[model samples]
Target: MRSLFFFAPLLRPHVKRFALALLLALVTLVAGTALLGVSGWFLTATALAGAVSFNLFAPSATVRGLSFIRILARYFEKLVGHNATLKLLSTIRQWLFGALFPRLPLPDRSLRHGDLVSRLTADVDALDEIVLLAIGPLIAALVLGGAMTAILFALLPEAGWIYLSSLLAAAIALPALLIGVTRGTGAALVEAAASLRAHVLDAIAGQDDIVLFGRKDHTAIRFAEAGETLSRLRRRQAFATSLAAAAVTALTGLAFLATLYFGLSAFQAGTLSGPILAGLVFGVMGSFEATNAIIRSVGKLGEASASAERLHAIATLPSAIREPLRPVALPEGTGIAFEGVSFAYPDGETVLDGIDLTIAPGEHIAIGGPSGAGKSTLLALLLRLRDPQHGRIAIAGADIRDVGLADLHARVALLSQDSPVFFDTVRNNLSLARPEATDAELFAALKTARLDDTIRALPRGLDTVIGETGTTLSTGQLRRLCLARTLLAPAAIVALDEPTAGLDRETELAFLNDLPQALANRTVILVTHAALPPELALRTLTLAHGKLEATV
Candidate 1:
């Protein structure tokens, strides 16, 4: 419940829309109660006074006006309510994305991709009940119930106590009971749904591997178990909601009977006329409409509370890296220095130990080593994706820690070993690094990466939409496309990890031969096992057992 209050700040911007929607909803309920009351009184009076004696014109006109107002108010109420809810959801998604950026490379690697997706999509969607189902409806019910009780007390004193007690029981006590009964089940239902979604996504992503390994049946059984768990929790929540609804119905019936009994006694004593008693009774029944909505949706209030807690938990997580209070400007020059740098993973596996190295501006160097030798970790430290546990890295004689992350990132660009080729057009993929780059500039980058010819051969050329992870392109072409993106970044220092991985031997050799010229004035740090041509005139180093050694 406390977590649900986290959204109050976000609700401020949309207050006007929400207030107007609430106003329209109240008008709709009030007009509906009046319509039912007037129609009951008009029909009885007309039957008693015959066609000529009764004044049908005034009562009929009043009923028609109330009905018209109810219809218009109901329509606008739905319109404004849904519009405001959707706009608020849009704002939340934007806020979540904004909150997510700085916390990238989240410390907790155990958080699966699918579970995160569920929180962002399904959990966020559930919050709509906060306004549409829970808050707005609850407010409307209270206002209508209070107004109806006041009218009964003023006109039909004997029945007012019965009506007020019944309204309080239905609107307040019943929903509270429902929430208490269903809270745990509601939260479990949300978790079970997210788990099921994660299993489905995992199966879809690993379908090929499952089939190849002959584990399809095992995977299917796992999925079935998750589905069953979700179904069981849903059934529990539904059963609780049904019981609450039944209680509300029973309460409504008893209240109606009691109000009618008291009203009849008053009429017998000549304190209340038949037409007025009928109107009051019908009004009492009409007022319970608000309670019905509140009862039916109380279960979702539990679900919304659980969803808010999950979202709040994720948004408030401690960031993996903290920005400095006052950042120093990156000095001129692209030279990089690693002075006695050492790093270890959270599991205490030392990747780099007491490593000292330096590269002058515009120098091209290649680092080679066996797998798991920490060549990649060095690059990550330089980019400040993860700071070293010991010593410091400097750029142009200034400690990189003192420089702003954005400034340091702009000064250096990296094409990692697992760099992704997004599901987008050839032009769009390349333009990610430089959105305002010209078609000519894009073609130049693609040509340098030796992918322009393949793209040109396609019917749509740069406009061709690639499949997910570039499934439409050959593995080598995909690698080259990602390479072109990295090359397009306007940075003085560029790091490429296994950039020529999927290229054939011929293409690999050709790319390496032309690499120096393609990156003429930029400092290049290449981490690969590929043999470099002597003509490239680049220094070569090797990393082994957490130490850097000059290659002969």
Candidate 2:
């Protein structure tokens, strides 16, 4: 229940619409039971009246009015209820995305992409059941059931007691039974469903490797096994729901029979009219329609709870870097200095130790070393993706931690080896860097990266759709496009991590020759293992054994 309250803030904005929806649902349920009870009484009363000068006008008019009310109220009720639910879902999804976006370079790679996809899509989708299936129906049942009890009590006290007790028992006991019997099954189904999605997505994403390695049969068998497991879990949940439905139906019959027995006694004692007795009995029977919702919803309570817990866990994960409570303004210059900066990973491996370095404004420097020499780690620290454990990094005199992340990012742009290109049009992908950039600016950046001609030769030029992760483009083209994206950013600092990683020597040197022109006044931090081309005259530094030293 505490987990469910996490959405309280999100629901506040739409409280009015949500309340109206619930009220409509209550009115619809009341109209349904009232229509049933009144029809029973009208039918019985008319027969009695016919035996002694029947007055059909009043009963006929009342019945017709109720029938129209029932039809119209039910129609509007469904419309409003569904609209509120959809709006709530939209709010929840937006909130979930906002919570997860800042934690981008997730600390753990083992938390597979497929699993996150499951949480973002399927798990978030399950939250709708909380409002629509559980809370809404439960409230309507209570309100309508109470009104029915009051009407029955006025007609016959004994009949009212029987109806109220039976309805309450079915509402309470049946749901309790459903939760007890199906909680584990609900949790199991959710787990199996998520795992199955992960395996299927992983399999599809790696289909090429599986086929090339002749492990297609092995992959197929694993996929089938996962499908079978999910199928079995779903079947268990279905069976439990069916069982609860059957139990609720039986309880409905028992409540009706008990009401009739007491109602007949009242008729014999001359305390209740025949029509009134019949009306009370039918009202008792029809009220269980609300209880049916409670029954099915309880069966899935465990699933909703599990989903809520998962969302809460993700929303509360510790950020790899912390922001300041009172952020100071960014300083005038973009020149960066790392003072006594040291960082160690969770596994106790020190990636950067006692590092002190400074790059002046508009200076171009290349950092070269073998793998695991902390070149990339330095770039990460400079970008503030991860904060140093022991020291402060300042930009132009103020600590980077004192500066707002957005302001810092606006001043520094990174172009890395594994930079992502989305499955979108070339213009849309490039626009991600600067959404308000003009066409001329975009083309200029592309030309500086030497990718303009490649895009121009394409059938749609900037509007062409690149496949997922730029699969349609060659490795060199993808890297160049990423560099172009970096160039589009209006930043004073550009950090390139192996920018020419996959290009041939000739192409790498050509791009190197163009770098100075593209980044004329920006402070540049180039991290690469390759030797710098002498023509570029870049200051060279080599990081070895956790210390920085100048190279030839």
Question: Best candidate per TM-score, number?
Answer: 1
RMSD of 2: 3.6
On residues 76-156, what C-alpha lDDT tens digit does candidate 1 reach at each position?
999999999999999998988888878777677778989899999999999884776776667877888888888788877
**lDDT (Cα, tens digit) per residue for candidate 2, span 253-351:** 877887788788878989888988777777777788888988877877878877777788787777767778999999789788999999887778998
Clash totals in order: 0, 0
Worst 10 residues of 1 by lDDT: 129-138
- lDDT accuracy of residue 255 in candidate 1: 69
> TM-score for model 2?
0.86
Top-scoring candidate (lDDT)? 1
lDDT values for all models: 0.87, 0.83
Clashing pairs in 2: none
Which parts of model 2 are misplaced by more than 4 Å?
44-67, 107-110, 208-229, 268-273, 326-329, 338-341, 353-357, 368-373, 390-392, 422-428, 451-478, 500-510, 529-536, 540-552
